[model samples]
Target: MANIKLALVDDHNLFRRGIASILGQVADFELVLEASNGQEFIEKIPRKMPDVVLLDLQMPVLDGTATADYLREHYPLIKIIVLTMHDEDRMVLHLLEKGVSGYLLKDSDPDEVEKAVRKVMDEGVYLNEFVSRAMLRKMTNKTTVVKQSTLYNSKILLSEREKEVLKLICEGLSTAEISDRIFLSPRTVEGHRLRILEKTGTKNTAGMVAYAFKNDLV
Candidate 1:
């Protein structure tokens, strides 16, 4: 495949710069554009399209939710991956219901962030471990308004490669270990980790294990 063009849409310049710098070292991806808010992201994208977008949930003019709605309405072909700090189950489900392809926490390490990018491009859903649990609980109760199958949809969305990542994560493998075992670069494993977190709604590996035990994924 050709190089993936990614756009960063977040209000924090420093965070955006940090992520860009990390992707730069990978030497195969490009941070094609950076925008402070959703409006700016829209304006920038009209001139060129990115394969994927790393969006922030909180922003001044256009938050990730509104931005996602607009993107889904207008540019259905473009994929969005939410990179945010919000761990609230409601907020996470809102983004997913908006059709975001991936979700990652802001506190996620840089390596996991990259894995998010790859998983979204290759698979379709990227969930953090903690986020997955919250989302699943809310989903099971049906109080969050996410349909019954939405959580199951997460499993269906992952590729075989991502499933491999999830199984290892549930088994307590660290990112570096997963990298070595999977023959993926560390950065790539990090990306997959982020993706797993988003898809399963689990935050850490331990949480993922609990989720597996609870759901019998193991």
Candidate 2:
């Protein structure tokens, strides 16, 4: 199998070089490119797109938050792992909101770094140990800000009637069955389903089901 393509983006020259050198020892990873800062990363990314990006938060031009936002819009295919010294919850939460795959501290060992890169590439998410523990606490307490908000927006983005129709669709109801359940015509149920897809960014029945699964909307 080919190695996973990776990009290292940071403001500090020495730090970038050091990480590149360390990753060189990992045969399963290929250092496809490097960027000095977030702005440089955005400009160079399209030409040398990597499967996973190691992004530093504090950069001269375009910080990690901005970089992540742009990536979410333009390069949604790319997975971002935040590599930063700042462990502040505010910054971490902001990047999470912007759709980062991993949150790793600068002090992480090379082994941990390699693990994070590989895990996110495979699993779509890789949180550092500390970040994972914090996330666990927040989740247990029902204080995970984004999860709730995404669900809430998904709710308002689809009306109450739409949600009723969505739940039935997610339960594997056909348009005809949904029509019988909701007293609407089959064509009307389909229209509601289409609007639900538009509201929730789902492309098909499977995607709609997945959205429902992830947000507990079912």
Quick one: best TM-score, which candidate? 2
Compared with the true structure, what per-residue lDDT tens digits does model 1 show for residues 1-218? 58889888999999898888888887679888899999999999988798889999899998889998899888976778888888776666556656687678888888887887876666455666765676557536643234434455556466688878878765546677788998999799878767766776753343444444344443
Index of the highest-lDDT prediction: 2
Total clashing pairs in model 2: 0
Q: Return the clash pairs for model 2, or none.
A: none
The weakest ten consecutive residues by lDDT in model 2 span 135-144
Candidate 1 runs further than 4 Å off: 139-218
> How big is the positional error of residue 47 in model 1, measured in Å on the Cα after superposition?
1.5
TM-score of 1: 0.65
Writing each residue's lDDT as its tens digit, candidate 2 over 1-218 gives 98899999998999999999999999888999898878888888878989989999888878888888888888988888889999875566456645687789999988999888876666455655566454344444344436765656546566788989988865545677789988999888889888877776653443454445444454
Model 1 CA lDDT for position 147 = 48
Each model's lDDT: 0.73, 0.75
